[model samples]
Target: MNRTLTERARSMRIHSGLPKQFWAEAVNTTSYLINRGPSVPLKHRIPEEVWIGKEVNLSWLKVFGCIAYVHIRVFKYKNGSNSVLVVKKDDYDKCNTEKPIMKMDDGDSVFKFDRSGPFFFISGNKDNSQKDQKLIVVVLAIRNHNKFPPVAVPPAPVGQTPASSPSPTKSSPSPAPATTPSPISHTTSATSLSPI
Candidate 1:
C-alpha cells in the first residue's frame, strides 16, 4: 500500500508539473483518489463505498494544475452600487491593478469569460471620497478547458413536434404567443484554492 501510494503520488506530481514543495498535497490527493477508486480485493467496489455502505459520487473530480481565475467584488455603501470583475491568471500573478478590463457604473452584475487565458480585474470607480465601502475578493483557481474535458450537451428528444396554435379568426386575429428563450447551461469546475 505504501509503495503504491508513493508511486501514484509521484506520477501525479510529475504529470501535473507541480513543484516538489507540493509533495504532501500530491500524496493527499493520491490517497483521496485511491480511497474512492475501485479496489481489486473489494471485487471492483470503491473502498470508500464499501466502508461507508453507499455509492461514491465522482462527478466533482477534475484534473490537477488547471488554469483558474479570481473573482473580485466590491460593494459601495454610499451609492448602493456593486462592482464585480474576474481576475485572469497573468494579472493575478503579477497583482496588477493599474487598468481594469471593463469598467461601468450602471451596477451591472453580468460577468462573462468565454476563453481560457490570464485576466485581471480592477475597480472602475475612481472616486475615493466614499470611505465607507466594503470589498470582498475571493481568489478561485478553477479547472480550465486545457486541464478538463468539456461537458457534453444532451441530445434533444427525437420526433418532438411543436405545439399547434389556435387558428386566428378573420373577425379578430390572435396575436403570436411570446416565446421564452431556453436557460443557458454552464459547466461546473473544481476549485483548487481552499477556503480561508
Candidate 2:
C-alpha cells in the first residue's frame, strides 16, 4: 500500500506539472482517489463506500493544477439622475474623454471585482457638457484579504460651487429618495484596474 501510494503520488505530481514542494498535496490527493476508486481485492468495491456504507460525492472534484476564479457580487445604489463611469488610472489622471472601462447609464448596474485591485468611479452626465458634469470621484481599493480603504470623495469639479455653499433663502422641493435593489451575483475575469 505504501509503495502504491508513493508511485501514484509521483505520477499525479508529474501529470499535474506541479513543483516538488506540492508532494504532500499530491500524496493526499492520490490517497483520496485511491479510496474512492474500485479495488480488485475488495471485489471491485470502493473502499470509502464500503467503510461509510454510502456513495461519495465527486461533483466538486477539479483538476489538480487547473486555473480557478472567484465570483463577486457588488451592490450599487440606484441613482437614475446621473451617469457613472469607471475609468483606468491613466485615463482618470489625465481626465481624458476616451472610452471608459465601464459606464453605468441607469446607475443600478452591478460591477464585479474578480481580483485584488482598485476601481475609480466618477459620476456625471453621459454627454460631455460642462454644466451637466458633476464629478464625484470615489476610489475603492480591493486587496487580497478583501481589505478596503475608506471611500475618498474628491473635491468638487472646476467652476462648480464648493460643498460649503450657503443655503437658499426660499425652501426648495426635496429630490426623490434613491432606492436600493437586491444583490446581483456574477462571475467574470479579473481586470487590470489598480491604484497608482
Candidate number achieving the greatest lDDT relative to the actual structure: 2
lDDT of 2 at 86: 72
TM-scores for all predictions: 0.38, 0.36
The runs of at least 3 residues in candidate 2 whose Cα sits more than 4 Å from the true structure, single-residue gaps closed, are: 70-196
Q: What C-alpha lDDT values do all the predictions have?
A: 0.56, 0.61
The superposed Cα distance between candidate 2 and the true structure at residue 16, in angstroms, equals 1.3
lDDT of 2 at 66: 50
- Clashes in model 2: which pairs? none
Writing each residue's lDDT as its tens digit, candidate 1 over 116-167 gives: 3334554433343133221323322333335545566776588885558967
Cα-based lDDT at residue 135, candidate 1? 33
lDDT of 2 by residue, 1-196 (tens): 9878887877766556555556676678889999999999999999999999998888899766454454343435557666667777665555544678877766566666554334655554435424434243222222133223555568889999776876777788789799865244334332311111
lDDT of 2 at 4: 84
Worst 10 residues of 2 by lDDT: 187-196
Query: How many pairs collide in each candidate, listed in order?
Result: 4, 0
Give candidate 1 regions above 4 Å deviation.
71-196
Q: Quote the lDDT for 60 in model 2.
A: 93
